[model samples]
Target: MKIERIYLLFYGISFISAHVNAFDPITTTLAVGIGATLGSIFKYFQEHCSSKWISFNSTGLEVDLENKLFGQHIASRIISKAVNGFMNNDNPKKPLVLSLHGWTGTGKNFVSKMIAENIYKEGMHSSFVHVFTSELHFPHASQIEIYKSQLQQWIKGNVTNCAQSMFIFDEMDKMHPGLIDSIKPYLDYYDKLDGVSYRKAIFIFLSNAGGESIIQTALDFWKAGRDREEIGLSDVETALSLSVFNNKKSGLWHTSLIDKNLVDFFVPFLPLEYKHVVQCALAEMEARDLEPDMSIADQVARDLIYFPKSERVFSVTGCKTIISKLDYYV
Candidate 1:
């Protein structure tokens, strides 16, 4: 009888221990579910709050444009107009089209990047921002047809998904002929066809087609002892447009986008001078977490080759070579 009572006591203790040690499956599941729910709510708020802030603020964008190397006025004006237009309730019903033309290293790509950075929170990495390079994306002339179809579908699909899309075409001077025309439809006016509206989208083209003309104009101003700042859009507008239209190698040479006056701005990026090269060097140095050194910057600028063998007034390679030159100096 005492053994039986001891066994009953041991069994009771064991049962109590099991209840204390093991968690209730339903309660544990509820705890895990609550944690997951809290995490999702936090993520949702984080994304929405950030997006709201970016969509409303333009100060960051304005400052970025002002800090760019060159084409300050034109870039700022056109970009502001585009951004404001996008933000405004009553604005034009067309896509903001900008064609950035200049020699290499003259800030065409830089300006594009700045615009992307300020306009979109994700910048060039944004899912809404699509970049197509001629050499890398559409190299083969024979594949132009396939490229055209793909480009159209891609644009349509993305725009349908999100109207605030940005498309950037780089190395446009190397793009195949008749391929850019595929996008002409999207750029043109359309009154909600198939429930797709592309007016809110932005298109940017970067090309070297008018590089020579721009250099010549700047050179003439320099020879005439005119201030480089005096060189206005009016001075190069006609010549630059004509050059691009006439050049067979240019992607927009025979395209309707040019002929139809669909291109809103033909922003010219002038070649960088010695001072600009120094600035670029300093900027690059600063970017690398290095202190800015005038001596190193000056040496780097002097090492660059300038144009007009006799005059040598401007850097032939512009800021394009500044980074490489800094590698040696710094």
Candidate 2:
């Protein structure tokens, strides 16, 4: 009876040791007969690591918006709405869709980066954050079908694994027409469909299709002697939407996504004035741990090309080139 009891104890220890060894090598037999305890320890560590991996801090995002991004009130408000939607547990029924429309260097990508940074531990580098650029990922019109399949599969797989994933489609104005429509099903209003729920996901489209209209409106406001801050979403929402829809080259053009009002917000990135450019220069300098000088910022801002040779309205490229130009001053 004593020998049989010893055998049973040995067998149990062997079994537990094997499982523990799969995770980490046992340095001592002190772990023997404590399989349940060891398993709990392993689980705790796993949970700790996972908890450290995914982090979303709303306060951090607000601070970034105030400091990093400048002259983008409408865009900021729309982004806040999207972030709030993601964080809200009550309204998890539909994905937050944002159509970021503006010219290049006007903070579309910047705002996307800010959102990713605040929402994910890895930020823009997060595996769950997928960015597809028209110029880089899907340039050829013939490859639209392939791109559509890949995009759908990618979204489905990631959302299945983690519903809080984010998809950023950049340069939509340059994407192949009708290609973006493949995502309509996921963006549609459904409680649950096709055995998957994409309600917790977020989709952001960055495009320059309606950029001209946005800039023109802002310019018009400037000419009318109105404070640039007075320009609101109500001022440009209709024109911007119509421009993006009517423009044949726009990826959203003739697509049900826009017509059906699947898009939650048409966040316009307004053209940056020289003062905004100066602010960007100062911010960039501060980012590099250098004390910023207004004289240097003024010089950098002055070098940037502005629109309407007559009025010299605003920075044509916004703050896109501010960092590069700062190298000369620093």
The candidate scoring highest on lDDT is 2
Residue pairs with colliding backbones in model 2 are: none
Error of 2 at 74 (Å): 1.5
Q: For residues 93-143, could you state the per-residue lDDT of candidate 2 as single tens digits?
A: 679899999988999999999988887888888878899989998878888
List ranges where model 1 is wrong by over 4 Å. 1-56, 71-77, 85-91
Provide TM-scores for the models. 0.84, 0.84
Over 4 Å off in model 2, which ranges? 1-52
Model 1 agreement with the true structure over 49-70: per-residue lDDT tens digits = 1354235247776776666555
Using alpha carbons, what is the TM-score of model 1?
Answer: 0.84
> What overall lDDT goes with each candidate model?
0.79, 0.85
